[model samples]
Target: MDFPQQDPAHRTLTVVGGGVIGLTCALAAADAGWRVRVLDAGAGERASWVAGGMLGSLGEGIPGEEASLALSVDSVRRWPALVTRLDDPGVVTATDSLFVAASATDIEYLRHLADFVWADQPGTGAALQPVTGRDIRTLEPSLSSRLVGGYRAVGEWSVDNRRLLEALRATATTAGVELVSARVASLAELDDLGPDAQILLAAGLGTAALWPGADLHPAKGEILRLRRTRWSVPPPGHVVRARLHGRAVYLVPRADGVVVGATHYEAEGVADRVPQAGGVADLLADAIEVLPGLRTYELTEAAAGLRPCTADGLPLVARVDARTVVATGHGRNGIVLAPGTAERVLSILEGVEE
Candidate 1:
């Protein structure tokens, strides 16, 4: 995962965590005139590495989540701009998503989602037009005949999160953000910056141990990556989501392969970051039922990561003092909200808070 080296002067900011959120924040701070260096655990198990990388929050929204949806949409809009800043446009694709229902009961849930969309966001519902089975076939010929109905979320998007993380690291390097690849015990352990230098704790779930006051916890998730085949029936296109058996599953197709996931383990008894056999079985079962072509696709990878979750499903982006900032607790939307979180942090440092 190493890249070509780049050099910069002394550090003015010390950011914890090397995930998307921390790197993006370091990049933003460097661009805003802070000589930055990122302290990273360099641990292999990070939420950004295992995320499904879907920027489609509309499909995930519910009846009482308008506020969260609004923030997520704002973050999605910031992604394209961040890509441009990285000078790498290939990291993102505006592949609007489609949500389908395979059973009669699933159709009711689709209606509920549609109702939630149209409740206040008028144009969102207009974009999410209901489609019959035939219409779905017309849009994506590979879908199975079992899908009864669905709606298209016109402006949603997805990202190759693995690539994005790489680009962020490279960009941070070029911007003079020294990356220290080691685990930091606590914020109090860091002591190199000058009196004016700032400290930002953006360590995701790692913040739970580094800054216990942050109240962060781990939400374990497992995802599967299937190698796409040219001979496959569906030909693998766009983002397809469905709840075949009351469990939510989404498939994101990329240049590398198709990512099928995920199984959420928010209750007790689910081991931290362990990929359960039952979870994998259920994910594969639901994924194959919706996209039958995936049945034959190569199972390239089965991995899991712990999302940095808070009691409330929103990231914490605020200033601790004139010289310290905190930005973590982005459970599932870490990739989507990284850029916005960076912008918010930089704004606060410049005497304005947003």
Candidate 2:
């Protein structure tokens, strides 16, 4: 299906949702000389706010995740150029990520993941090097002496999501992107708009609400922020993650604070809820086990956000109708996947065959 050629002089786009995904689309469209408006319900806490912002492509590798892996890598590749264009202070930060495994089972899984990436592309997985306990300690002296072994993914990076969102919002404003604080009840409301007007459904889980049966679900993730001074030992310069009993926890250190998270719960709905004490306790305990120094850190804040999940786990960036395009279901890698998704959306809108 081909969309009508939008007027080059004044293309108007209405994006639903103000989270990272929606904001990204709005910014990209606005930068392309489109008049964009973002509509967000602004009712509850969003996932973007609570994210740890780790841009881990290899670290998130799982079987049948090839599409996601490709999207992540492409997004990382575009960071340099994208950051330069944004002029945002917190656009991105290059930091290595460590994935540690304590038990034999988890060790095998980590190795398999590392091998999968390496097998697919030799140097692609160079960042993920098999390391021993001493090597881990040499890199991050603050780690607990209990660590057995792990892999260091070197080229990984993270973005301060709060700052990125702020920057995107600011850029959108500067580009004349209008932001409306209102929950979009349905996608039908955006139906059959004029040639100059385009409707983009970029609302995370809210996209599912608008188009019932849309392949989008919410994956609840809880995160905790810790004050930097609370730690007796200095925080790790790079993000640290450990896999225990098949579950994973990550400790991300930023300039302003350290974020430790997260717990994936499929049963939870997309409601705005303060992070549970139990969740924070679990994250703290995991962080301490990975790096004992974190035990001294004081909890500054706890929050929850629902990741937009899909059946295939790949983002949906397709035109659902003549005037409507849908982009959602980014899962845990929303920040990492935003650029690639935006590029695809633009391609489809421009009638480029994908």
Give the best candidate by TM-score: 2
Per-residue lDDT tens digits for candidate 1, residues 298-340, read 8989988888777777788877765677899887788878877
Query: Per-residue lDDT of 79-173 in model 2, one digit per residue for the tens?
Result: 66666667875656436888888788888888888776544743574556789988889998988777778888877887788888888788779
Best by lDDT: 2
Query: Would you list the C-alpha lDDT of every candidate in the order shown?
Result: 0.78, 0.79
User: Model 2: how far is 178 from its true place, Å?
Assistant: 1.9
Clashes of 1: 0
- Estimated TM-score per prediction? 0.91, 0.92
Query: What is the Cα-based TM-score of model 1?
Result: 0.91
